[model samples]
Target: NDFPLVLQVGEEVVSLGRIACPIILTTLLIHSRSIVSTLFLSHLGDVELAGGSLALGFYNITGVSVMKGLSAGMDPICGQAFGAKRWAVLSQTYQKMLCLLLLASTLLICLLWLNLEPIFLRHALGAGQPTRAQWTSVIGISLAFGYAILACVFTNFLGEAWGKLYTQDPDVVKLISIGLPIVGLCELGNAPQTAACGVLSGTARPKEGARINLFAFYLVGFPVAILLTFQLKMGYRGLWLGLFSAQVACVSMMLYTLLKTDWKHQAKRAEELTAAVGERDDLEDGLINDSNDER
Candidate 1:
């Protein structure tokens, strides 16, 4: 196929002889991952297809796209490192990034498992269909984790007295008293970092979020945690300290990225994408006025 592939090289134009094959191949690979499942559902029935498609769309919008965007941040760093012949650093960066992505994927998968009922209810699955086992597991997991987080918040705000609600054992209560405040401090930093990452992903600048994570978690946070945990003998508190520091770093970096982003440019690009899709939809109702006026 004679697909026009133009490139500007030193004020001169050039064309790739056959670019369509590569472009088509790339498009197929990227889309087929999601589309294949929808195709499988299509064979089941119209309802199944519709529901599957809707759930897939929701996930693509809320999760996978954001993950991909954050991963893109590695592109620049990897490319520059390769070009500069810093092979060791490039390898290290790639390893760290892979580990981070795997960790995030694991955590998200666990969360998905724990929230199956709510997910089903929100999607095509009818309400009240969730089994007793599903409800039991969901409630159990939620309570187990929820109480800890809730206690952390209460303890942070109310101080040592809040620990008394959980246990009468002096030793356990003392541990809780120490852990709650640390967890709360970590959470305070974590909230903004998480929000900033979501915002960055939504704006199509995932690479910035990736850089923030790399520097915050691997570079600064890990070292501090090790130092405090081993050298200072701070134990679990040191781990929480590391988390707080990393979150603060991430928040600061994301805040700067937010301030520097060119909103006008992003808006223009979004409009262009909307127009492209609009042009492709022949049944678009809003375009009726234009057609009528023309007739």
Candidate 2:
């Protein structure tokens, strides 16, 4: 009841406000979905809900967070390099991120798959434990979903890709606009394919790809998915299915957006490339200088 709300208007403020709202809401929706799923299961029975939440949180904190952190470094690099169109740097970042995500995610998934029930479920149940059928189902569901969570880390790299693409060609934005609706067509089952497309696109395009993904995931993808999931009561399956809708929209948008991008032409122009590279280098140097001064 004591919650406070504030609204203000200014050019810079509005721009930031616009960006902030979607991100906050999207992330909130994700957490809400997780909590609600637990609540739904809880309605079925307390032990089921509590135990489920515990295992979910554990896997997320230990496995999910670690992978996200390890692979997320590409965000800054992609954001900056993409704007600069440093193809060499962008290429390097993509390879490194892919390699890192693969190694880190593999190990995390293995451990999670191995101990889905033992560490997450049984520990929650304590001495007596639930029926074999129940625990077995939990283990199966947990492990089945583990592969999906692994996708999030790779998805992080997409920010860099889309960011670079946006920097290279603004037209891609328009393309993504047209493409988004088609993805919407996939309707309920778009996340896995969409997410995979995003990560690959991000890793490939770095600049525009990452930026597009950030928009799609944080903005279009997530919000749309959240609405479908909550309003339609898609449940766990629905939630995952809804995820695809966002990805499809984003990927299609990016493709349409790419129709306008002429990075190859931009890259071939020596003077333009030099100036762009120099400008980018200056920014990096400035950051390093600032860091040095701070130290």
Candidate 3:
């Protein structure tokens, strides 16, 4: 028997909200570190604020993004394992992911310590349920809209004076006024793209998300940024426009992928992934027990 359409949707919203709310809060809390640091930096001086911002941006690209991306890969494996009641597989997968992240972090530490150039670059699940995917998209898009509105309101309220909050330098304030709004617009794309990524994670298809990101940023976004920044002489504004373009491309692709996703297929894949790991765990356990018996 099927439930009413409204009821089904209501339930989905409630369920997704339950999971999403805590995640939203946790994300805000995590990023609050950087926010707080920026606040402190702003009080130091213009040069200090600028330097701190650059450092934070670099750390985000190299350190935080790397760890977050790698750790996200485990979401599907762990979610599926738990869903299937494969506790051992879940535990093992979690442990392996932690080890992987630790190794990645160590490598990143070395790279950050040695590298000179300003360089670059940059979920989980209901395990492939389409209803969840759709609602998640809706929620993400909704949040993006909300953010855009808030950004606009804040930017207008602060006007060119917004920069004064961070620095006494008129030049710095001018730059902030121009850049801040564009950054806000970019979130129009960033928010939804992030939401779509969550859906992809839940469905055990992080590789696809990665591919989309690569194509969107490198193939589409970067080229556009270059053209606008250098070719058109848009300068910093152009650079931000490039980011906006990238975000738009990324979100479009993400939403399209989610729309076209075959959720049933993903569910089957999740089952298989969890089952294979479960079997391996069982095999390992059996072997260990046999060794103990022999001893």
Angstrom error at residue 57, model 1: 27
Best by lDDT: 3
Estimate the Cα RMSD of every predicted model relative to the unseen true structure: 23.5, 24.0, 8.9
Evaluated against the true structure, the overall lDDT of model 1 is 0.51
**lDDT accuracy of residue 112 in candidate 3:** 19
What TM-score do all the candidates reach, one by one? 0.42, 0.34, 0.77
How well is each residue in 77-145 modelled by candidate 3, as lDDT tens digits? 566566566778667767777777768878887331111110000011224343454454565556656
User: Model 2 over residues 187-260: C-alpha lDDT tens digits?
Assistant: 32234333333322222233455566688777876776677768887644445455565656664665465445
The stretch of ten residues in a row with the least summed lDDT in candidate 1 is 113-122
Return whichever of 1 and 3 wins on lDDT: 3
lDDT per model, in order? Answer: 0.51, 0.45, 0.66
Ranking by TM-score: 3, 1, 2
Q: Which candidate model has the greater TM-score, 1 or 3?
A: 3
Per-residue C-alpha lDDT of model 1 across residues 1-295, encoded as one tens digit per residue: 2122233221111111132235447658868877678657756765786688798888776767656644654443343234334456446556766676667667656221110011111111111122321222233323334444665567587655654543345765577677778877666556556545644433334556778899999998999899988999999888878877887787678667765655444433322222322533221232232223210
Which residue window of length 10 is worst by lDDT in model 2?
115-124
